[model samples]
Target: MDITLKSTLPGHQNPVFCVEKGYYADTFFTAGNDKGVVEWDIEHNAFKRILCAVSSSVYALRLIIGTPILAIALREGKLLFVDVEEQKLIASLQLGIKAIFALAHMSWKNELLAVGEAGTLHVIDLSTYQSIYEKRISTTTIRAIAIDEGLGRIALGDKDGQVYLLDSTDFHVITDLKLHNMPTTSLAFIHNKLLSGGRDAQLVISNPNQLHDNFSFVPHLFTVYGIYPHPEAPIFATVSRDKSLKFWSSDDFALLKNISREKMQDGHHLSVNAGAWSQNGQYFFSVSDDKLVKIWEIKKIDKLVANS
Candidate 1:
């Protein structure tokens, strides 16, 4: 695949914490230590507008699929539901989480899972948009959550460097492993494997139920903040505090593209906190502590057939 910097967008006054593909086709959203969720148009390389404003720093954002509501996770332990179609705040849910770091929608189960600071996990029934269960699974902050509905597993990573695979139905720990010496900062399930990254600058690929089937490597110089897989391709991207975004092959887990800050003129100079691929897989968006949102244009390589 061939990737290049398409544009650099600057607007956020503070470090950008998270980025997520919006409910729409060509749109995406980003937030951080910012006051509002800013929406951007990927097709025209422009800012759409602030979808809504909140009272605290935004740590995470996710879309409630099949609807106009966007879930905004705030720093003060509150979840805000915003109606993007009307550009208004719909409702709020406070679970006493202290802060929220990640959110995942189990659309198949009609549930939403939110895990965050103080090791709190909140399960909300989308049917009612209310808390179904709230529990503290760890003594420290839980930084990552990945739900595999097909496999019936929920992968949780914590600041204590522990990784747990839980039963998606009951949220019970199925497998437990210490994968990092420092905090496990990110986690994602890709192609039947759980890909985890951490503050120890390491990346690990392992099976959810079989703990012996796994391998680890140091892929960054600092914290690996986010792992984002392409919407359709067998490839994924990991961003880090080292100020670079790395593309890896899911087929062999090989490093394919490294967008390093030192070489790319538009690359992030500070910690690249998070990234998300466009819904159509034509472009990629990354945000950083440098307070810039960068759009990267991607092109899949095509091989011509050999003439007989």
Candidate 2:
């Protein structure tokens, strides 16, 4: 990948598990073992402020676009809705499960879907901020979720190493694929294709239309905790417990760059828990067990060519 470490934002008191887009294009949010979700200004790599404080660790965060509301999933299965603009906890709901692992916002359906240790998916009606539906999709935990709006499909990966494609609106299972030998820890929709990462340290990218026909490779030495696809670039990144962040070609899933502890003196020493690209794809952010968020500035291809 034609990228380099731009700067590191340090303030999270504990391991940061998730990073997400902020209200603006130049801003973003991150949370994890820490007690509050944090907002950062990317322009100066500055920590803006704590968006909201929580009682337990945060596992995932999603900002409802065009609104000040921030959705937080906690380790204890409590989901909090906070209005960042007003800076107050507006609503809190318990999904009645433990360790809510992921949350997918369906803008088209105006719902929030959360999955966790219970293997039951909780559907929250964003309009009411209440649980409207719940269903157990696996005997094991559903650790990852990715909604492909263009395809009208939602991809879910479970602790059983199985990835299921579901009808986004009706929540009916369309197809299931066994992509890993261990728990499928992360999932992403790179355009129309589905990419998955696993505890087996494997990365599999496949055409969702024909799930069985796929490409697989071992991308890390430990569990792949995150898979972040660029909103506009032809590349994606995966962070791992192996304490490394890697960039891959979206076209062929080729290893483009491997930023590891062995190669970079400034890389995360602990497991890189999660990563996200900015809404404009100008920068990439990664959070880790080391209690830090590192930002990578992307240099444009045209700029690189001119410099070359």
Candidate 3:
């Protein structure tokens, strides 16, 4: 599979922490260490507008399903709900002394979850915009979070290399597994399996009932910074500190492709930080520390299937 560069959007002054595609619109949102959230129009390749002002660096941003409300997490432990259409603040929840690192939405339960630097997880109801559940794990900083909306489960990873699975309805700890020898940097879920990548340069896949010794690990050469599942394919993409992005088959974890900016003539000069697959599954987008965003289109075959 060949990746074709479509366009580059340049304006961010800091490294992008997260990028999320809109549910029903041809738009995407980005948050970063710059303490700002910027929306973009993918069709026109232009910036839409800045959503809200943040007190500290924005680490994560997620748009709730069936609403214009966007949830944002700050390094200062504050979660803000902003009205994207009206460009106004809907609600702000202060997590008191715990710095938030990741945020995700559990659409099945109509709830939002935020993980903090102190390993505290707070679950909030979108309808009432209230904190319904909160708990603290024994780990250090919580670095990443993923929600299995269909199963009504939440998975959280911390800097101390632990991953915990919780029942979304009652916020009870269902299972706990250690994922890495070092801090876990990212977590994702595709199908019935949970995927985690970390500072130890390892990626592991496991089920909820598995013990730490039972999970299988995939070896890599560099610290994994990001892991995202392809929208419609049985494949996943990972970014590493080694300056390359890897595509792996979900079925057997086979290596499909490796992408680096140096291999592409117009590649950015800094490390790749975040990536997301386009809604239609025809394209993929990635950003780097160089403050550049690039879009890659999947090549078409004679049969017209979009695969790499």
- Candidate number of the best lDDT: 2
lDDT of 3 by residue, 168-191 (tens): 778788888777889888888876
Candidates sorted by TM-score, descending order?
1, 2, 3
Clash pairs (backbone) in predicted model 2: none
Of the two candidates 2 and 3, the one with more favorable lDDT, higher being better, is 2
CA lDDT of each prediction against the hidden true structure: 0.87, 0.88, 0.77
Among the numbered candidates, top TM-score falls to 1
User: Residues 1-308, candidate 1, lDDT per residue (tens digit)?
Assistant: 58989889988999999998888888999999988999998878899999988889999999888998899999999998898999988789987849998999988888889998879779998877899897778899999998877898898999989998888888887778898899999999898888899999989989877545889988888999998877677788899999999888878888988898576666788999999887777788999999999999886522201110
Per-residue lDDT tens digits of candidate 2, residues 1-308? 46788898889877888999887778899998877889999988899988878889899998887788989999988999998878899889988748999999999888999999999888999999999998889999999999988898888999989999988878888888889999999999986788999999998888876577688889999999999887766788899999999988777777888988899887999999999888777788999999989998787844533433
Q: Of models 1 and 2, which has the larger lDDT?
A: 2
> Could you tell me the TM-score of candidate 3?
0.90
* Clash counts for the predictions, in order: 0, 0, 0
Q: Which stretches of candidate 1 lie over 4 Å from their true place?
A: 301-308
List ranges where model 2 is wrong by over 4 Å: 301-308
- After superposition, the stretches of candidate 3 with alpha carbons farther than 4 Å from their true spots are 212-220, 301-308
RMSD of each: 2.7, 2.4, 2.6
- TM-score of each candidate structure, all chains considered together: 0.95, 0.94, 0.90
Which of candidates 1 and 3 is the stronger one according to TM-score? 1
